[model samples]
Structure formats: structure tokens, C-alpha cells
Target chain A: MNPMQRVMTAMGQAEPDRVPLFILATMHGARDLGLSIKDYYSRAEHVVEGQLRLREKYRSDCLNPAFYAAVEVEAFGGETIFIEDGPPNAGAPVLRQDADIDRVKVPRLEDCPGLQRGLEAIRQLKAQVGDDIPILGSVISPFSLPIMQMGFEHYLDFLYGQPERFDRLMAVNQAFCVTWANAQLEAGATAIGYADPLASTTLLPRAFYLKTGHRVALDTLPRIRGSVAIHLGSGRGLSLADDFAATGTVAVGVSAQEDLGHWKLAAGKRFALLGNLNGVEMRRWSAEDAEREVKRAIAKAGQGGGFILADNHGEIPWQVPDEVLLAIRDAVERWGHYPLDWKE
Target chain B: MLRGGADVDELSSDLRCALESLERSQVEKVLEAAIRIHSPLEVIEGLIMPALEAVGEDWTAGKVALSQVYMSGRICEDLVGRLLPAVAQERGSFPRCAIAVLCDYHLLGKRIVLSVLRASGFNVLDYGRMEAPALVARVLADQVDILLISVLMLPAALKVREVRAGLDALGSRTRIAVGGAPFLFDPELWREVGADAMGRSAADGEAIVRRWAGEGAP
Candidate 1:
């Protein structure tokens, strides 16, 4: 089967030719293309070129057209700071004070250069790959975008203190998320990677999120077209497995803190499981370590399909050596076959 | 002011529970009662600090959410400012300490660490967000004795080495403590980055500061 067929089969909880590899390489694409991060992410063609080159080199299944997470903030009229070594960061938060909330208006996709590049990349990649490969697009969830908008501490204060304003902000962000995700889908993305780190139980009480962030997600995900994979950066969210599955997402991205087998068991067959590998540690991993991790992950969660091998955090760090990616690729190719027989 | 002769441990436990539940009024009430009977420092060190530490411990264990711990720290910071008397002698007794977010904009960890240090009666300089060279220059200019750096990303975490080398080039004796997601994920990363110590939480940061201050070693 082709890579897209393999991923679709897994998403359907059926055994594919092999477990599909979704190496969540975003900024690393720029690194691989020998372009400065700013230059590489400046145009959709650069991103598409980087993605194609990365897939050809690594032999990964999915193509991620995402530039960086902070680019989502730019759509809200926020500025971004591009760095030499890593992903661009959101500049000074857009909402420093409560008054700034009124100034926030959902931007036209064409006006936002950062998001326009991403959408164009998706369009370009789709035209090229043509469903032979899955193109994953990403968006910052409304509940978590405030971390870049008003800052984490201030956002929490706003969340706990001013309920009405919090609702107002969520409404704005929710609209943006739906609009952005739908635009990516319309641009021919196979799925949307919904990043909502703040909604993770690590950041907020599950009960609190159920009433607040969960509602936003529930209200937003259905409006977007195509598959949605909910990823909570580095949050430990084994307990939130069911909660995430209930959010109308096709899969949930688990963190390094969760065991792959446990997450699979908790999630059951309700949705797919996309990750659990520690990307940070992967930076320092030897080839043997990479192989061992692959075998272990496949052995644990690759039982009845519904598992796409990837890192805990959605993006691979630019600092990770090329050897690590190669090792992971080779390991997955070797050990990621279906109906695997391995001991615990 | 000790209502019904409340035990320190019991009061601290109650405070921790209140903090975990995010009951701001209950936290204030507990602090007020404790402060009436004990000296301000005693109330902070014996009651408020311990309660915050418990919340931090719970957070580390994943038993409580970070929002609770963050809110608890913010609440205590406000109460500490309002309730604690200005003990001039105790205020500047520790080393000249400052906390900065090195090359990253995320300030949650730094804010919590700052609050914990202040509640523990340490005068800490808040440097806000700074890059490596600017941070090094400011530390040198301030003659900072101890520097605490927080970063959310790995690249920013690695910048700690640059800050360390900068300080060494200047022949400065400012000891550095690193904290953040990167260090917490990778043990021995602090030492690898030439930091004197690493803290997993705000409570751990305060303890490191106290230990380093007591040793009087740079």
C-alpha cells in the first residue's frame, strides 16, 4: 500500500502494510534545506521544497506543511522573531493588557503572511503529492493560543479572575482556529494537528478544562474539515486520553511521560494514537537506542494498528542530528511491520 | 491570634489544601490568622512557604495541575507583599540574586520561582526576558552573586552555556541555577551547561537559593 493508504488503514484501526511513520519535522526542514529559518519559512514554495527534500531523505510517510506554532499568533496581528537555530518565536505578546483584547480581530488569511505561507505550502504539497502522502497541517487551539497572546501567567489570571473576558477571548480564538483549520483543509491538507497544550491536565485541572477549554474544542473541531489530531506538546496526559478522544479528534498525541501501551489501552479503539517518543531524548539517541525505542513502541502499541509512530512533542527540534532522524527512519522500516511478535 | 491553638503542621496542611483548591479567600484567611500569632517571617517560613512547597510537590507528582500551583504562588506573592513587615536586616542578608528568562518569553517558571524566593524572605531581582549577551552584561553590571535562568526550549536552555562562558570571561563569581522544562526532562543537563544547580520546581529553586546562601560560596 502507499503511505497515505497505510496511514488511512491505521486510522481505521486495521493492519496496514506496515506502521506509518509521521516524523513531525517542521523547522528541521529548513535546517535540512540549508536555508535560514526565516528564509525557508518566508515562502510556501520554500516550505514545500523543504518538506519534499526531507521526505525523500528520511523516507517518512506523512508530509507536514506547518512552518511553526508561533505563526498562528501572527494571524492575530502578532509579530514573530525568527531565530537562526530554532523555530520562530512569537514576539512580545499581543495582549499585554485587558484593553488589547478589544483590538484583536480575526485576520483575513490572505493578509497574514505567516499563515498564507503555510496554506500555500499545503496547496503546493497537495498538488505535488496528490493524496499519495498525507499532508498534516497544524493550528494552535483557541484555549492555548492565549499563552502566546497575553503570556501564560497573565492568561491564567484572566482565566481564573475574569470569566466574561475569558469567554470573549475564547470566542475570538475559536473563530480563528475553525477558520484556519478549514482553510488548511480546503487547501488539501489530509488532517489538522490541533495544538492545545494548555488544555492538558498537566496545565489545568481536568474538571476545569471540561468546563472551559474542552467546550471550545468541542465547539470548534466539528466546524473544521478532515481529520483532527489533538496534541498537547509536553503535557503528561494519560488521564486525558478519554477526554481527548471525546473531542471529535481522529487521534490524540501522547507525551513522553505516558506509556505507549497504557495510552493505547486507555484510548482503546476510539481513536488513533500518534506518539509517545521523547523528542528531547531522541536528540541524543544512538542508532541502537533508536532501534530499541522503535521496536518497543511498535511492540506495545502497534498490535491492532491505529498507531502512527512520531515524537511526543509534535515538532522535532532543529538541534537533533541528522543521524538520529536517519536512525529512526531505518528502525521504523525494520521493526514497524504489522502482526509483529515481540516479548514485553 | 492562634485560633484554637492551631498546630503549624496542621495549618500548613490546611493552607496546602486551600491552595490546591484555589480558594483565595481561604488562603488569605489562613495567612491572616497565622500572621496574628507568629512573626511575619515565622508565618512565611513556617506556614506559607511550607504550603507552597506542598503544592509544588503535588504538582511534580502530577497529582495537582500547574494552574493550582501557579495560582497558589501568585496568591502567596500578593499576601506576602501585603502582610510581611519590612525586616531590613533580613531582607538583604542573602546574596545579590536575580532571576531571568534566558532567550525565551515564557515567564511562568521564573514568576513562580521569584514568588517562592520572595516569600522565603529573599530579595530577588526580576530581570524579565533577556537574551544571553544582554543577560550576561546585566548580571555583570548588577554584580549579581547568584543568577537563576529559566528557559522553555532546548536551544534557549543550551544558551545557558553561553551565559556561563560570558560570566567566566568577565571573571565573575555569579553562581547560576537553571530551571525549566528542558532541565527537568534531561537530568545532568544543568551540569552539562555549566550551571551550579538545577531546580525542578519553584520550591526546589528556593531550597537551592537557601543552601547556596547559607554556604556563602559563589
Candidate 2:
């Protein structure tokens, strides 16, 4: 089966030729290509080239050219500092006072230069390998926007101290997510990858997630065309996995610390689980050790069709040796296959 | 026999309330009321740090969100900023220290560690965030006895190798200690990155540094 079909089949809870792969290879690609992060974030050609080169080396189902989570905030008049090698980070809060909420409007794609560059890259990527593989566009989910605007600390204060204002702020961000996701769909991205690391219990209470984080995702994500994936899906995720699945997300990005089989049982077969591999271990451990981890995760959950092998969080590091990527690729090809009921 | 005969229970309760409210002014007011009867060290070690830790506990256990935790961190930073002048005066001739956050989301841990280091009687120098060269140069120049680094991501944690090599290149023997999310997730990261040791939180980090300093003290 083709890459798209493989992903679609697995996402649909049916058996495919093998479990599809969708590694978050954004920053890693930039570093490997030796492009300044400023250029990688602004130039579609660089992003497209980096992505294609990485894909050439290691086959994957998703082409995420833009993983800079700060673009939407930057477009919304938020301050950001572009580092030489790393992703751009949001500066001080955009909405300084309670009054700034009135000025909070959903930023248009055309208005956001950074996001526009990414969309253009996705369009070009589709034109190049669009038919054979799925191109996934990324957006920082509304729940994750607090870190962008008003900074993370102030964001928590806004969430708890001024509950009503926080709701209004999230409403503004949710609109942007909807508009942004729809535009990516229009731009030839077959899937929308929603990155909401803050939704986990590591940062929020389960009740708060179900009430605010889950609600925002449910209200908007389902409306997008093709597929959707929410990341950092651990931290009390086992209990709330169904709520996340109910958001119509086809894939869940969980950390390696998560029990994959538990997620398989909790979220059921309809959703594909992406990641469980520790990025630190992959970079720190030897090639053989990294491969061992890959095989171990596969052994636990690779049996079922609904699994996409990926790092738990962050893109794979550039410092990782090429042999490491090849080793993981080989493991994916060797062990990440379906028909679990097969007799060895 | 406290400095100003302040009621420890009453001051602790009030200070805790101020920090929970997350307003630096309120925290300042609590400090003002306490300092009349308490020494700066007593208030910081007794009142401010305890409140911040309580809030940190709430944040760690998920009763409070990250934003609240960040606010508590900001408040601690403000309190430390206010107290540093007196702290500097009091801790004369203490061992000099330097700290750098190698990555983001470091404000909380950095502040906590700074306060702890000062409270534990170290002359703390917060270098804030810096590139590799500046980080290495500052450590070498100051002859920083214990260099504490904060890293919040896997990439930054991995980048610790470069830091270790940089220190080696300069032939500086600054003992490096790492803290934050990456090390917390994988303790072996400390040894793997070739740091002198690892610290879990601000106080825990201070304790670790103290142990190392104590062992090294002639």
C-alpha cells in the first residue's frame, strides 16, 4: 500500500502493510541542513528541501515543514526572539492588560509571514511528493497559546486568577486554530497536527483539561478536513484518553513513559498512537540501544495497526548520527508490522 | 530568640497567603511586616522560601497550573531581588557562584536555586541565559566554585556535552551541576552529560552544592 493509504488504513483501525511512520523531523532537518533557524523558519524552499532530504534518508508518512510553535503568536503582534539554531521563542505577553483582549483578533494566514512560509512549503511539498505521501501541517493548539501570549507564568495566573478573561482569550486563540487548520487544509496539507503540550496533567489538572483544553479541541478540530493529531497525550491521559479521542483526532502523540497498550485499550483501535520513544535516550544512547528501544515499543504495541512510530516529543536532534536514524528506520521496517496474530 | 521577635506561625501564614495571591506587592507587604521583628535570612529561609515551596508543591501535584507556578516563581525572584542587597552584605567572603539556563522555561528553577544558594550563604551570580562562549567565559573569569545550569528540553540536555568540552578547553575546573525537566526525567543525564552532579529543585540543588562545597572545603 502507498504511504497515505497505509496511514489511512491504520488510522481507520484496519490492518495495513505496516504501521505508518510520522516522525517530527522539523528542527532536526534544519540542523542537518545547516541552515540558520531564522532562514529555515522564513524560507519555504529551505523547509521543503530539508523535509524532502530527511524523508529521502528515512521514509515517513507526514511532511511537517513548519514546527515553529511561535508563528501564530508572532503574527498576532506578540514579541518573539529568533535564535540562531533553535526554534523562535515568544517574548513578553502580547496581551499585557485586560484591555488587550479586545484587540485580540485571529491572525490571517496571509498576515502571518512565518506561517505563510510554512503553508507555501506544504503546497510545494504536495506538488513534489503530495500524491505518494501525506503532508501534515502543524499549529500550536489554543490551549498551548498561553505560553505564547502573556508568557507561561502569566498565562497560568490568567487562567486561575481571571477565569472569565482566560476564557475570552482562549476563544480568540480557538478561532485562530480553526482558521489556521482550515487554511492548511486548503494549502494541500492532508492532515493537521495540533501540538498542545500544556493540556497534559503535567501542567494542568484533569478537570481543567477536560473543561478547557478538551472543550477547545472538541469545538474546533473536528471541523478540519483529513486527519488531526494531538501531542504530549500523557499525564493523566489514560483516564482522559477517550475525551481526547472524542475530539475526532485520528492520532495521539504520547511520550515513551506512557503505557502504549493501555492507550490502545483506552482510546481503542480508531486512533493511531504516535510516539513513545524518548528523544533524550535516542540521542544519548548508542545506535544499538536506540534500536532496542524502538523494537521494545514495537513489541508492546506494534502488533495492532493503529500505531505510528515517533519520538515522544521534540524533533529528533541533529546531533544524532545518521547511523542512528538508519537503525531506527530498519527497526521500523523490521518489527513495526501488523497481523499480530501471526505465528512466529 | 528570632531577630525581631516575630511570630513565626502568624508570619508564615500571612506570607503563604501573599504568595498564593501571586502579587509581588502583597509579598513585599508581608516581608515588610515580618522584617520588623525578623532578620532577612529568617524571613527568606522561614517565610518566603517556604511559601514558594508550598506553591511549588501545589504546582507539582497539579492542584495549580504551570502559570500559577510561574507566578510564584516570579514573585520569589522579586523577593530575591529585593533581598539580594542585604544578602550580598551579609554573605561577605562566601564562595562565589554562577548559573545559566541553557534553555527555556527556566525562570522557576533558576529563581528557586538562586534564592537557595544565597540563603545557604553562597555569593550567587545569575548570568541568566547566554550563548556557549559567554557562558564558558563567565564561569572561567569568576572562578565560580559551583556552576549551576538549568535545561528544560532534551536537546539542551544533550548540548551539555559541548559545555563540558568548552570548560575543558579553557582548562577551567568549574564543577557543573544541572537541574530542570531533562535531568528530572532522566537522572543518568547528569552523569552522561559529564556534569559534576545533578540537583532536583532549588533547595535540593543548594543542598547538593553545599555538600560538594563542604567536602571540598579544607
Candidate 3:
């Protein structure tokens, strides 16, 4: 089967030709294309070229150029610092105080420069790669969206000090998520990656997560235009895996920090499981070690038909030697075939 | 009458409560009450730092969220800023520059580090998360004794090599000391990123800067 077919099959909870690959890729492409990071991320043409080049080089099953979560943050009153060879950082939040949350107006999603660039890139990527390669667009979930409101510090203060205001702020964030997801889908992204780093268990108590995180995913996932895979962070994501799987998402991005054994039991055939690699360590790993890790991940999570191998965390580190990425793919291809041995 | 000495038990409780609640006023009031008896340095090292550790523990234990961590860390940042002028002179002195590194905006780690550095008597140049090129310009211009590069992302830690090159191009002798989540996880990463050394913690970073200040840059 082809790349898209493999991913779709796995997402469908059925076996594919092999284990599908998924990763959050960016800067690696710019380095390959000899393009400035400025143009690579901001300019649609370069962005498309960058993703295409990476897809070709990595031979991954999906194309998701999640450069940074600040795209929509910039749209909603935050500034973004776009460096030449690095992902952009979210700017100082325009909404600093709890009072400011009241006056906050969601910006026109279509007009947001960051989102527009991504849409154009997605369109170009879709046009060139066609349906054979599934192009995914990423968006920050609403639960964590308020972090961009007045910065993380103030948002936390609101979580405790200003309950009513906090509820309103979340409402506004959910609205923007819905609007942005629809826009990306309309623009050509075949699926959405509901990137919610804030909802992870590392940050919140489960009580808070259920009300805010579970609610946001519940409200937003169903509202998405198509199958949306959720990429969460921290071990808390593991605890919430069952919750996420129950959200009707296509998949849950599992981390190496989490036990893939538990995920096999928790998610089961409900949705596909992607990732489980320690991305930072993979970069610094010896080629031999990197392959060992890849083999280990596939052995544990690549069982049955529900696993798409990838790093459990955010984007691939820009500076990780290209050898590491190649080593991972090579190891998976050699050892990731299904309906065979998983005992080792 | 202003308090003349810190009540170890009373001040500890006050500091703990203020931090647990993240009440700026309570923290200030308790800190102010304690400062009359104890040097702000003593208050930070003895009271505030311990409270920060508790909140940090709570965060790591999953009892708190990023907001709590950020707020609690910010409270400490604010504490140092408020207390530094009074107590900074007592600590040994050094000149340094620090940045949160490019592409990562998580600054609580750097903020706490900056505060601890200031408390350690370093006249730090706060170059808030600028792009590497701009940051390189400031570092070269300032000619600091120690360069504290605080990076949370692996890519940002790797970008330190470029900053190291820029400093080298000028034939400058500035020691680069990297800290933050990434380097803390891998002490050897300091060398990987061309940094002269790695700091295990805020207190450890202070020692790294002091040594670099006296010995000059690598």
C-alpha cells in the first residue's frame, strides 16, 4: 500500500502494508533545500518545498510541518518572533490582565498572516503530492490557548483567582480553535492535528483537566471537519490517553515517557497510536543506539494494526543530525513488519 | 516597631502560605516583615528558595500546572528583583549576560536563574530571548565575563554553537555557561553546544559564573 493508504488503514484500525510513519517536521527541510528559515516558514512556496523535500527524504507516511504553535497566537493579539533558522516564539501576550480577557476579540482567522501562510503551503503541498500523501495542519487546542492570552503566568493566576473570567477566556479560545480548524480543512489539509501541550497531565490536576482539557477536546474534536489526531505532551498524556481515544479522534500521539503497553490496552482498536520515541535522546544517540531505540519502540507499540511510529513530543529537533532521522526510518522498515514476531 | 530579626518558624510559615496562594501582597508583606531582621539574601536563601522548592515539588508531583509553576517562579523572580538592590552588594560581584535562547519562550527557568545570578552578585545583562544574531551582537558589545545561555529546547541548545562562533570570530574571550531544562538533562550537552560548562541548578550556575569571572573566558 502507499503512504496515505497505510496511514488511513492504520487510522481505520486495520493493518496496513507496514507501520505508517508520522512526525512533526520543519527546519530539517530548510537545511536540505538551502533556504533561509525566514522564507522557509513564512513564505508559502518555501514552506511547501520544505515539507515536500522532507517527505521525500524521510519517506514518512504523513506531511505535517508544525513549525510552531504561535501561528494562531499571532492572530489573536500575540506577537511572533520569526528567526532565520528557528521556530517562531510567541510574542508578549496582548491580553495581560484578567480584565483584558473581557475585551479580547478573536481575530479573523482567514486574515491571520501565520494561518494564511500555513494554508497556502498546505494547498501547494496538497496540489503537488495529491491524495497519495496525507497533509496535516496543526492547531493549538483551546484549553491551552489562554496561555497566549496574557502569558502563562497571568493565565494561571486566573485559573485560581478569577474563575468566572477563566471560563470566559476558555470559551473564547474554543471559538478560535473551531474557526481555525475549519479554515485549515477548507484550505486543503486532509486532517487536523489538535496539538494540545497544555492539556497534558504534567501541568494540571486531573480534576482541572477533565473540566477544561477533556471538555476542550470533547467540544473541539467533534467539531473538527475530519479525523483529528491529538498530540499531547508529558506522562499526563498517558493517563488521559483513554480519555483522548474516547474523543473520536483518529489517533493519540503517545510519548516514550508513557508506557506503550498501557496504551495498547487503553486505546486498543479505538484509534491509532503514533509515536513513543524520546526525540531529544534520539538526536544525541549513536546511530547504533538510535536504531536500537527504533526497534524497541516498534517492538512494543507496533503490534497489531493501530500504531504509526513517531516521536512522542513536539517537532524533530532542528539540529539532530540527519543521520538520526534516516536511521530511525531504516530500522522501522527492516523490523516493523507486522503479523510476525513481537516477542523480542 | 519594624521587626529586627526573622522568626525562623513564623517567617517560614508566612513564606509558605504566600507562595502556596501566589499572593503577591502576602509574599511582599511577609518578606518585608522578615527583611528587617534578616538580610534579603538570608530571606531568599533561607525562606523564599525553600518555598519555591515546595511549589516546584508540587508541580513535579502533578499537584500544580504550568500556571502555578510560572506564577510561583514569577513570584520568586519578582522577589529577587525587589530584594536584589539591598542584598546584591553583599554577594561577590561579576558581570554577565543571559538570554532564554531563540525559538523558545519558556522563561521561568531563565527568570529564576537570572534572579539567582543577580543574588550571587553578577551584574547580568538581561537579553530577553532575541534571535541568535541580535543576541550575539549584544554579547560581543557588552563583553561580559560569563555568558549564561538558558535554553529549554534541544534545537535552541544546539544553536548555541552559532553564538559561540560569533564570539570566537571577534577573538573574544567570553565563557559560555549553558543551563535550563535541556542542558540540565544532559550535562555533556554543554560541551556538545560548545559551552564551556553546564550548571546543574540556579545555585550551580552562580558558581559557574563566579569561576568564569575570576578565571576569565575559555
Q: Which candidate ranks first by DockQ, i.e. highest?
A: 1
Q: List, residue by residue over A150-201, the lDDT tens digit for candidate 3.
A: 6665666676677777667777788888888887788778888887777777
TM-score of each: 0.97, 0.82, 0.80
Interface RMSD of each: 0.9, 3.5, 2.8
Rank the candidate models, highest TM-score first.
1, 2, 3
Ranking by DockQ: 1, 3, 2
Higher-DockQ candidate among 1 and 2?
A: 1
Candidate 3, which CAPRI tier? acceptable
DockQ of 1: 0.78
Residue-level lDDT tens digits of model 2 in A1-344 = 88889988877777798877766677667676787777666688888988998888888777777657777787888766776545567776687777887677877778877778877888899899867888888788888876767765456667767877767878888888888888888889988888888887667667777877888888878766667888863333556687887888888887666687787777777678887877655655776786688777766667657787787774665455667777888877876776654324
The 0-to-1 C-alpha lDDT of every candidate, in the order given, reads 0.86, 0.72, 0.73
RMSD of each: 1.8, 4.6, 4.7
Q: lDDT (0-100) at residue A102 of candidate 2?
A: 65
How accurate locally is residue A123 in candidate 3, as Cα lDDT from 0 to 100?
A: 80
